[model samples]
Target: MIIELDMSSDTPIYVQLRNQIVKGIGKGEIQPGEKLPTVRQLAADAGVNTMTVNKTYQILKNEGYIRTDRRLGAFVSENINMNAEFRDKLESELELLSAEASITGMNREDFLKLCDEVYSKMKSSPIQIST
Candidate 1:
């Protein structure tokens, strides 16, 4: 998967990188146990600083999206845990998006339809990772 960064966007470079990686995993473009580029390699490819990639990797690790090994570097996690904490985070983000849709004059039905479309598009069959 290619990582694209918008230098002018208000979002931080690390956040953008993290989001893209997560989206890639969700879309199955980056499969579980797939190796990720090293911090320096990704930095060079994305034209961002190594620190930015490192930060993104750290965040992904903390969020259980990736795992790191001293010898192997980073790879997508085989099993992702969606515990209560994650559910709360998802709820918070959805609440904000729902509010925005309401403020933009999107009716409840339309908003739900849009949500369903996105969920369907991103959903993938269960992936089994080989060690």
Candidate 2:
């Protein structure tokens, strides 16, 4: 998976890493149970400090998005369920964003079109449905 970062942005490096991992999971770029690159490796790839990668990994581990074994390194969490409660929570959270986007000049039609595009792309990709 390719991770692009904006050095000029106010967001922290660890935050960028965490968001990328989340999007990667949602987009199927990183499969469930998939082995993630080592912290040192990802840091080297991103040209960032290893501590930053370690911190991002720690956050992801806490979020149940990744797991690390003593020697196995980090792997994507398997069977991550977006349960009904979680779904409703996400919907509620996104409604705020949708409202903001609307106020910021994104029309409902355009917003939904973008959603459809993303859904199509995600559907075309190999799916890892967690029951």
Among these predicted structures, which one has the highest lDDT? 1
lDDT of 1 by residue, 85-118 (tens): 7878989999999999999999999999998988
- lDDT per residue, candidate 2, 14-115, as tens digits? 999899998898788998899999998999999999999999999888767899997989999875655565567679988997998899999999999987
lDDT of each: 0.92, 0.85
Steric clash pairs (candidate 2):
none
Which parts of model 2 have CA positions greater than 4 angstroms off? 83-89, 123-131
Ten residues in sequence with the least summed lDDT for candidate 1:
122-131
* RMSD in Å for model 2: 3.1
**TM-score of predicted model 1?**
0.93
**lDDT score of model 1?**
0.92
Report the poorest 10 consecutive residues by lDDT, candidate 2.
122-131
User: Residue 131's C-alpha lDDT in candidate 2?
Assistant: 29
